[model samples]
Target chain A: MATGNISHGRILSIQSHVAYGYVGGKAAVFPLQCLGYDVDVINTVNFSNHSGYGRFGGSRASAQELSQIFDIMDQNGLLYPERLLTGYVPGAEATEAVTALAQRLRHRSPKLIYLLDPVLGDSGRLYVSPDVVPIYKNALHLATIITPNWFEVEVLTDTKITDAVSLRQATQVLHQTYHVPHVVISSIPLKSWLLDLLPAHLHPASASASTSEHLACIASSRQGSSSTVYATCFPCLPGYFSGVGDLFSALVLAHFTDEPTTEGETSLSRAVSQAVSKTHAMLVLTHEAAAALPEDERTVTDEELDVREPIRKIRRMRGRELRLIQGQDIIRGTQPIEFRRLQAWDTFWDA
Target chain B: MATGNISHGRILSIQSHVAYGYVGGKAAVFPLQCLGYDVDVINTVNFSNHSGYGRFGGSRASAQELSQIFDIMDQNGLLYPERLLTGYVPGAEATEAVTALAQRLRHRSPKLIYLLDPVLGDSGRLYVSPDVVPIYKNALHLATIITPNWFEVEVLTDTKITDAVSLRQATQVLHQTYHVPHVVISSIPLKSWLLDLLPAHLHPASASASTSEHLACIASSRQGSSSTVYATCFPCLPGYFSGVGDLFSALVLAHFTDEPTTEGETSLSRAVSQAVSKTHAMLVLTHEAAAALPEDERTVTDEELDVREPIRKIRRMRGRELRLIQGQDIIRGTQPIEFRRLQAWDTFWDA
Candidate 1:
């Protein structure tokens, strides 16, 4: 638990590397590192490529094999202080071990951030085996933050969040129901009641009628004195690299646990947001260049995707209060300002 | 069968819509038609994204539900496909139905090019469910051009192809074994084999000494003509995109089925190479862009992914008679070629 101070050693992330870079901790660990969080990953499955190709080395790990690594980590005292982030836990064995690991982490350091990128349905459909959702539901309470897309938010909260109000209602229920105070409903496509109060110029959703439909996406940075300067962004574009949630959570956990000097208003929200922007810029710039190249050159572009793009970089996390940015917010610099003030969402202590 | 010549007809192609666009005929289809093939597609499975995103809606396709579309097509006499291009046949039913359709087409026209992009494995690993590969094996004889990557080729030929000699030998066996004459091994990375025939100069197995040691990827346009000039190139970079096979097949089908006046060469090899260059360009233009965007905007660009981005446009199909490059080649392409050598692989009839 000593790692929880300024220099948190690393985060122990376990995932189903069933597909290559799209899911699991492969995508998550990188951005976390970018935000200064070291991550050690254990892949449950090493696929030739993702399953979508309909041609891959079928699932390789019996949950038992996957757990052996975790068991070793546990034996080595690695899990003690380091946070845990998991995505797409494949079989019953993986599910069983990960849930246990989460508990162990909690017992070891109640402050350990168990961030789960509950990669469930996107655009009204579930991607994981429905059988696994329940297991994921079980891990809900252990997580400090559960970042789900709209469909997942709906599933976790059992509420259909098709609109903004419902989304907020769902975010509340998600945090309330799961007790994971910080809830980020990524890709949520609507404006919220809170954004109405921020400067009309800073409300990004209002400026671009085109961008207003973005699903709700949140990343809280350092806890501050004045207020968590909640910031919000409309994904300037769509089709971002997969596995971004993993990255965002790792970033949030690193910044929060590190006790970084996120001045009052600027908070961890701003710092994480900048991390996200840096990751996004890295992905986007590479992708543009890749797009410029011939197909033969296409390869794994990012360890984690630029989940949110071109959003202003959040730097001064300590004291700056978050203000609403207009849809033109994307045109602004990359800075993470806590944008949303949800009684439901929290980065650290739930109470 | 008579409709094959109809520039615009519902070429009911069966493939998967890579929840995202890693596969299926999504982004590549438009570019293909831009190359000149009227294409209508049916997804065998609707995944959350590419299987690589861990998973989404675990490959759900009841045989009955999958066949409904084809059943309807049967009623409309549209089942008699002039050209059938297939990639990643999901389940037993899809494989059988497509095979049956291809068989019927051959029976009726004997000239129907069932260009099968045998998507089974890559780099010596299988991604398809066990049940699917065997079915594909059975259907291989029904395809004219069996385009397999290095791994799939090895699986089918049972020959460990190392150098150009082995490749040539393997091609013959593949042609003989699968009953197809044209065996296009995409992106062969061996630099020695690729002296003049260059592109995707990706060398899969070269030692570190002056060897890229990257996968040898070949983007080629094959024509069924006397002077077969394969326009082979490597992206000269390292990356992996799953649905690339689907796009390649679509490109080959598009190029050979049309006539043109673009350049000097008049051969199937050149034609296939041209398709490879064009497809490579489209992939290059879209791949990283997709990496940068979310699930949707990946295909649509900041402006437009001009299929005419120098590399994407097919100025002409060389190596036989006519060497003309038309918009149909770039604006609306994606059907079988005018010649018929590759068909030998897809069918067991008189080659």
Candidate 2:
């Protein structure tokens, strides 16, 4: 029974809800429930909105408080996880505890998938602590697949990356150094995309020419064996919003879990590309929803027509109707508009 | 001899840092510093990165740990603050104790300014624990200004707002019910450049595009001061970063001190707006500096460009040289391309 059996075990994700009050975890939980994953999220911190935009409700719980959560999980036998997809683990102590948990999982099951969205720095900068870099270093080996932006890739591997050549070079170094099998570098700002030296697509043009559609997708290459570079760009019509990574991580995990027959199907390149495509589509559709409204009133709600009350509106989408959830992309600004939700897995191939 | 000389005092704040390590007291202290006030911050939470993103670090500090901070402040004679600006006070026990502190501030300084963000939920959403909201409500009556997004405003005021009429209607009830002089209803998707919607202007795309440029300025009117709404928008830009309220509250205390001469100049509307403008400009100029870089490697570091490193990597145009400290904006998302260490008093103007 142990010989190459596709195991259907539990995945416990320890991440923060990158939402203000209603959308992040509150809204996130709905799609999670729809995806058929027994998800128990340890909200490291909950604010009124994502920290990127900078205002939110207060915070509760300390990093030490998370240890208590693990204790509770142990008391209820909930810690028997087959996979631990850690998202935003708050601080040094929590990282230590999580590293210990990774060691524990290695001992407990030996094959638990640890997909880490190394939520640290972005856009050629590290936003957290210098102390955190080392903690994440410990995690690099523990993680089966590590998701980092171009900036973090450089920090982790200490390689100056600029293009596909350098990105793969850094990814290779990262994989070898960290001992993680797969590394996906996201948001690598291309030279072409920089709107007048935008530098990593952080540029805003003097005026909006229908809002340029920029994308940062996932890519990878098989070491010394494959004939291709694993890369895909998932572009979106840009307007700032938070929690894209949280949603992406959830989608990747769901997709991995969805394919019951194969634990490793295709390279990380394909999986992330597909995931990015889906995410980009969802974002586009969200924009269309916003565009349909008065410019000032454009925002998406999981519920229908919240036009009557718009003050407590969400900046991001909270996609309800999981069964309706399809692999079809949400309407992008430029893409075909009829974005239907996932009715079946076939949508992925068809799309 | 004691002819009501404006009471000299200090306030303290404590919170987390995003990219850097342990921005503890700075979250609270820096804001007060902007207002030309002295402060001491007791960091209850210390992490490598903020919890908004997927931070991988530890959090250490307990009630006992917090008490040690208070002990230090007590020993140093910094506890006799005339006002207190509290943001992101984590834990139920801390909430309980803070209520007591709010009460103590009033008792110790008869005219103490207690400005609470009451960060339960913005945009009609709740992010904290079910218990935390109630705890916030308990402390609301003691607040001089309770700044919440529209979502939180509704929950506190129990109003069904659809238009300006309802918003005004809701504002009256909030002031009457909460007894807080000013209620900064944030993220109120409206089309007014008036002074009252300072909080909304702080949010993104919540107002008209034409009116959104002049940030940090207030479109404000006091409670029951309907005729006070002005057509001209105030410009106090650099107030776009996270935890600016924490800073604003600190400034308000100093500006609104019980002095006769400074009283006229230190109007709440004027100081907050001025601080807002300075913060906005700091962040904006930083972005412009970042934009000024060469294409492709526009996201260059000071070390990369062979220029003297701005302390916070953000540059503020201080006379002939660009100064970079830890600059932030009162409004989120509208972060300056760089940071500066300039103060609100250094940049803001009278209404």
lDDT of 2 by residue, A1-351 (tens): 110112234456666542212223333332343333334445566433344332233354465666655654453334666667776666777777777777777778767777787878766667677787788887788777777877788888777865445655676676566677766665665345223322322332223432235444444433452223344333445454455565666555555543433332354544564456556555554555446556434454424443444232432322111111221212111224432221111111111
TM-scores computed on chain B for all candidates = 0.68, 0.64
lDDT of 2 by residue, B1-351 (tens): 111112144554544332121122333443343233434344445343333222234454455545544543343233566667776766767676767667766777767777676656543556567677767777788877665656776776667666546666666665665566655543444345332443332333334544544322222334363312211232333212344444444443444444342432324545444444444454455455445555542333345443443322222111111112324223221343322221122111123
The lDDT values for all models are: 0.49, 0.48
Superposition error at A81 for model 1 (Å): 3.7
Model 1's alpha-carbon lDDT is 0.49
lDDT of 1 by residue, A57-78 (tens): 4234455554554554343223
lDDT of 1 by residue, B1-351 (tens): 121212332244666643222356443344443332444455555443345422233244445544554554443333555677777767677677767767766787777767788777676778876677767777777777767888787777777766556655556665555567455676555455444223332222233444333234332232342113233334343344456667666766665544543453333454465556555544444444435444432232222333434211111100010101111222123323322112111111112
Instruction: List runs of model 1 lying over 4 Å from the truth.
Output: A1-7, A18-23, A33-38, A52-54, A58-60, A191-201, A205-209, A212-216, A219-229, A238-240, A258-268, A295-351, B1-351
Residue A210, candidate 2: C-alpha displacement in angstroms: 13
